[model samples]
Target: MKTKTVYCLSGLLLGLLTACQPSDSNLKNQNVALQLQQKALNSTLGYDLVESLTVEVGPRLPGTDKDIQAVNWAVNKLQSLGFDKVYREPVQVPVWHRGQAHAAVTSPYTQSLVITALGGSVATPEEGITADIVRFNSLADLKQAAPESVEGKIVFIDHKTERHQDGHGYGKTAPGRSQGAAAAAQKGAVAIVIRSIGTDSDRLAHTGMMRYQEGIKPIPAAAMSNPDADLINNMLKRSDKVTLQLFLSPESQGTATSYNVIAEVTGSSKPEEIVLIGAHLDSWDEGTGAIDDGAGVGIVTAAAKLIQDLPQKPARTIRVVLYAAEEIGLVGGKAYAKAHQHELHNHYIAAESDFGAGRIYQLDWNVNEAAVNALQQLTVEMADIGVMPGNNEASGGPDVSMLPALGVPVASLRQDGRDYFDWHHTPNDTLDKIDPAALAQNVAAYAQFAWLMAQSEIILRPVAEKQSQ
Candidate 1:
């Protein structure tokens, strides 16, 4: 009886050990598959995609004929790449045209100042408007100044942006460009001029979208080149009175139709669950839109293509979205959320790549507690490529930011954006700025994360509350 009991206990311990240990052969096969996919993505496929888009389609501003052409191009491209389904969803976008713009310091110094009209700004009269300049060091200073000090003046907000890898400086300084016009108008200023929200000290001005509050009157707004802003500051130090003449011919052309291009790789098992990857398609019309978003399109598209080519389909669908009118605002993103509100619960995970072709350095996520272990395992798999794990507070970029509000999980593969703002929305944002190696690195990181998301069975959100006994 004692010998029989010993044999039974030994058999039970052996069964438990076998169940706890992973099959080495299966693990080896998975590693080999991942290695093969990464190697292919780090090749020339990603670069070729960006090159074709930037060269063939060029800048695709929202609500323009080129925008339509871009939508068609993306559809054809995705179909050619063998996506299961490709389609376009219409989005109504505001059309704002930038005509001719000129600014000159007329009084203290007669010199032409490099400037570009901010998007959505009202047109200055054909003859132009000349006024004494009131310079403020920052937007907060402008807000605190007495109304009598700014009435009928050209308010200049001269806050400078700093360089940082994480791009926090752009967030800190962007408000001056986005809201300065409305704030100045509220204070009775005739117009507002701000230093370009860029890190470079170049002569080219960066132009982006600005907003006017509902009740606040719209006014002419522009961004001066960094060097020109410095010139204005120096002149203000010498003399309090610096008069300027500004002429801008921008006008709103009302609403126009744009599209969000979507393509998908169908899943073999759970077709209803989705892993979304996104990037914006519209640009500011200053350059070829190479680094701003053309790179992002290439990265995500190439990642999806790589996954689709695998011998076996993933467990969940991989959806790639090319959003529209992101430069103006997140119009396409907002429209997508509204259109797909009912199915948002099935979005297993979401991410976006809009911060240029810089190499990804860290991974951040906003998933459920139950999904944390899987994310940690993914980070370990990506360690060989120089990516580290980050905190859980992820914004998932501009296009998919609305998802988190609806309880959809999101992640961010944070890229090194130290020099992103230098050429952002400027004429300098051209194809020459992108490095092929960095672009390849971006594809590798994105492809790995996307694959993990599509393969895992982990539910990313809506953690069930513990049952009461």
Candidate 2:
């Protein structure tokens, strides 16, 4: 039901009036926003979308056949949903194969270990490296080790990741996975294995991207389960000599084409000004990618779908971007920022839902000083979902984090991430892990936020702002 009365463009007459907006239309928008929030809270549309994605497309590792299928799926879904605009922008992404990984203790205590290769790592020799083990409790200890001692050995960094509501714990121990290979190679190690950067004690190895330094010896890197890491730690204490046979066959097969799928609900009046929300379309090879990002795609799309079906068109456009290759290194996010450099100022505000399907507990934003009060009503509307106003230092999530620096204001609806890392990059990240009710709660928050942001007389930038990307 499209509203017949289109409101005036606030961006067009901002100079003439501070917070220029029709009071009657503002109140009407609030009434619609509250209705949208209620609809979202009671709907399982988000869960249905994610279920379709995981079941139909499965895992969407960037550049894989499934990744291409996912792009096609997104286009069809957006078109089927009857959005005003649907399109895609090409993005070049590197292709890597997980192949196979095997790790086992050959000496002292012979036992197989659960492990997965870190993304972008090289394959080991066919025979694999069978060497003595050298354990380090942390990355710092590895860096300080004597070269002679680490030479001709397998380095194991047994650092453990903690659990927290905000998922800051993953950030804390992520360095060991990202830099462990480089540090181990510098100490003259043949290979490296780190404790999985997850809070779970289960025997599931968490896989993620890793980096190698220039001119440093590149070595095979992998992560062992927390229990396996603990097993190795105990093995080291009991015996003077412990050996592991490692074999990983992951390899890069050049680059491939991917796309950032874009869909929009065009505003009736202020169409030039945009209210953007996004989630990564790509996921790890391990699981169906349900929790890592399938849930995110569903959440944002469901939110936008609700807005699109609204009786009255919002004042600002609502754009939903399902980004490509975000799992590797935020490729789509960086590409979007660079491609839209000329119009960054035109973006009214943005948000992203890359965290797992969880209840949104807080609303956070990073707007200019004068624009802060414009969000008060939006924050109050979020109260029904148990969300409170958070600090202004929000990064808008992994993918959306790229826009703010390019001068686009941003917001983050912080989810309950306490159990996120447990299934983050493991085989356990599947549809069953997501609760429909919790997913609905996320949709409720996102729909209310996006609808209100588009309808309200929000100021993304103060009159004093002049710098452009």
Candidate 3:
């Protein structure tokens, strides 16, 4: 019996030794760590943050009192979240107020019209301006019209939108809204109105920023609701000599100081290397900016919070930037680029969630070929969260676009934009529009990506000149 026991003990010791081989042990440890990370990220809490932002601070347009309040709210929230550092950087933003917008058909038929001021549009006089309405089937037609034909007339360029996942209709139909003022001014038109570039058939109008050329006259511009646009079209179909009146009091009220809210979670190992997550702080003034960016604020902050809660610190730092005035010509993005130009090389990856709180369907990236394999691996890890590989031509969000010039690699978690344009920049944008499950999924994806990127041995691509050397 003693001899049998000795033999059994020796066999057990040999088996243990084989199992403890370095490579096998490392693999076991890796699998265990991965499981822990997955568990930590599984109970994502993005909805809590998003709900807090949408319900608490709401509608943070730049230069407005609400915008300032939002900055204060974000600062307090970040500090409460246990971020290592939370601060605000001031950005001098253009202040344009939409006082009141009114329009009506005077000649062919008398009826009221619903309209909203286009961003950056100059206000019309108090009494408003009445002029003969000229109809243009498209931008090309407006451009070819005789100057005298459009002089002192309100130009209407009616172009319909078609739906696509990428919001391609916006690109195809934007010429009317973006250049209508300048194109009409060049043709001697007084003011311009275009059909809202949205796929929805509802009466709500979508408003966005519009630019006038340097030398051209800056005229009042506005977008009419789809139904109202139909009314105008119906009137024009009967006669080309319809008369219209427009009254908009949108004005530039000098200058105001808006701020971008920033926070950081320090890393244990490579502290200098940085991963950035961002969302726009400023929203359009019409409605609460819930879907547009409140969802974004929720997503990034929750991701950071999850990382902070981890037992071990990530290998690299994570920065959360809530940009200001993204709605008005990327004012905050440009300011951030200029302010952080020196640290661009340190940015390992930057991403922003600006689209509505729809489910994230795809992930795009803008990094060198070397980064693809790593991102592909990341995609597989996030597959349960419904994230798929997307186009590599990632331009990033409006705010994140500024980072690439500094050679910062970008990651894109593309959300489902199927219904984004419906409530985007419209008065209907509210907290109820967000899906709690979808928001939580977003948090899960962001948390996992940020954590793995921070912890991974593989150095991400777009390694700046300074880092590579």
Name the candidate that leads on TM-score. 2
Best-performing candidate as measured by lDDT = 2
Q: What is the lDDT of residue 166 in candidate 3?
A: 67
Residues 3-22, candidate 1: write the lDDT tens digits: 11000011123213111233
lDDT of candidates 1 onward, in order: 0.84, 0.87, 0.78
Q: What RMSD, rounded to one decimal, does every model reach? A: 6.8, 4.0, 8.1
Angstrom error at residue 192, model 2: 0.7
Could you tell me which residue pairs clash in candidate 2? 1-311, 3-311
lDDT for model 3, on a 0 to 1 scale? Answer: 0.78
Cα-based TM-score, every candidate: 0.92, 0.93, 0.89
What does the lDDT read for residue 190 in candidate 3? 86
* Residue 236 error, candidate 2, Å: 1.5
Candidate 3: lDDT of 186? 84
Candidates 1 and 2 compared: the better one by TM-score is: 2
- Model 3, 70-166: lDDT tens digits are 8988999999889988999999998888888999999889999988989889988889989988877778888889999899988887888877776
lDDT of 2 by residue, 399-464 (tens): 878676677788889999999998999999999999999999999888888888886665656322
